[model samples]
Target: MEEEHKFIIRTYSKAELAHLYNPDMPLVSAMRKLRQWIRRNKQLSSALAEAGENKRDHSYPPLQVRLITRYLGEP
Candidate 1:
């Protein structure tokens, strides 16, 4: 009798998730864009931030928000 091997998939890290979602894009560039967007759209950013800070089950703001906020001052 031959023994069969089973393979298990592992979850991605934060960096891995980012790269997988946006391949070929520099991490820094992606973050910058996200921040910029957040700065421009304060309401959205605030909502998302609140959700996260409060530990609510809500999706995060788009990556553009993170990128935009990083480069530009928050609104």
Candidate 2:
């Protein structure tokens, strides 16, 4: 018999996301930098690709917190 592995995906609320980026900075600016960080880091492309699979809204694509942590090395 073969064993199957399951992974849990984590999603962050706006407040949590902002804190992860920078608790000392403004939330709006933190989010902007987070987006820019994602764009510049090509290694994070796989994480974004996974996010695309479960995207709910076209205007606001969902980002996986676990994947972000994996690539970004946690907050």
Candidate 3:
């Protein structure tokens, strides 16, 4: 008898990420900035969601800014 193992893997490419960043952007060059930003700051997405649910004032640079600063460092 032989033992079998399974594993999960994920992959991402600059072009793919760029497309995600901006669907409107030219396929040739979407910049991928937003995609990279999200990848780098996964926490931001969660934090933003939380802020939205709480109905907190997101306009001012507070919740988001603070979270971003803590994760990415001072601007």
Candidate 4:
């Protein structure tokens, strides 16, 4: 039998999530990098848009966060 750990999904501000992905980088730089990653990922971008996500929004809803984690793998 294989054990599968479930990841908890939650809302996160863009900066917070970005920092989780890049702890060593400055917050602003991490944010920029996170934005680039999202922008460059077509599927994630469209999914976010379809879920009513605004590019300028400061936070991600739980659903959007899940989508991001799915594509980018837990950051």
Candidate 5:
């Protein structure tokens, strides 16, 4: 899913994404780091907020996931 190689964009759980980004860290810490990264990016944060902010939400919608990947460059 790194390049344009026919990757299928899909919804991802927060925990799943956190694990993807920081498998070396504990789950909670990893999730916190992911959230921190999102919050730190103004463009990404605003876009997500416009879509409907819900930090407590368990998973990301397909489109929101797209934005995340676009901003964060594919977990």
Candidate 6:
């Protein structure tokens, strides 16, 4: 019998995240701003640091998701 594995994977791409952040803004511009915001926010930076490089460079972890939702308004 094969082993079974289950887990929830949560990640948003640049385009998706951009749209989530601001639908009215241009995609490239929004993405740039989002990156800057992630780097500038203390709570977000710390969360990213704790989550490590994988979660930092690639996608937002669960903690970051909560923070983003709280701060950025339901992204």
TM-score of each: 0.37, 0.62, 0.37, 0.87, 0.83, 0.62
lDDT of 2 by residue, 1-75 (tens): 999644334556645665666878887788777767777887785567756733342222235666676777666
lDDT of 1 by residue, 16-65 (tens): 43444446779766545544554577775665465453224223344533
Q: Which ranges in model 4 have alpha carbons more than 4 Å from their true place?
A: 1-7
Candidate 1 stretches greater than 4 Å from native = 1-24, 53-75
What are the runs in model 3 whose C-alpha is more than 4 Å off?
1-35, 53-60
The TM-score of candidate 5 is: 0.83
Top-lDDT structure, candidate number: 4
| Span of 10 residues, lowest total lDDT, candidate 4 | 4-13
Worst lDDT run of 10 residues, candidate 3, spans 5-14
Q: Please give, for residues 1-75, the per-residue lDDT of candidate 3 as tens digits.
A: 899643112232435434543668785556445435645676876775665523232232355445544554442
By lDDT rank, best first, the candidates go 4, 5, 6, 2, 3, 1
lDDT (0 to 1) per candidate: 0.45, 0.62, 0.48, 0.91, 0.86, 0.65
Candidate 6 lDDT, tens digit per residue, 1-75?
999644223566656776667778888888888878877878766766675635335556566566666655665
Question: Weakest 10 consecutive residues, lDDT, candidate 1?
Answer: 53-62
Number of clashing pairs per prediction, in order: 21, 0, 0, 0, 0, 0
Native-to-model Cα distance after best TM-score fit, residue 42 in candidate 5, in Å: 0.7
Between prediction 1 and prediction 4, the one with superior TM-score is: 4
Better of 3 and 4 by TM-score: 4
lDDT of 4 by residue, 1-75 (tens): 999766568888999989988999999999999999999999999999999999789999899999999999985
Rank by TM-score (best first) = 4, 5, 2, 6, 3, 1
Report the C-alpha displacement of residue 10, candidate 3, in angstroms. 37
- Candidate 4 TM-score, true structure as reference: 0.87
**Compared to the true structure, candidate 3 yields what TM-score?**
0.37
Scored by TM-score, the top model is 4
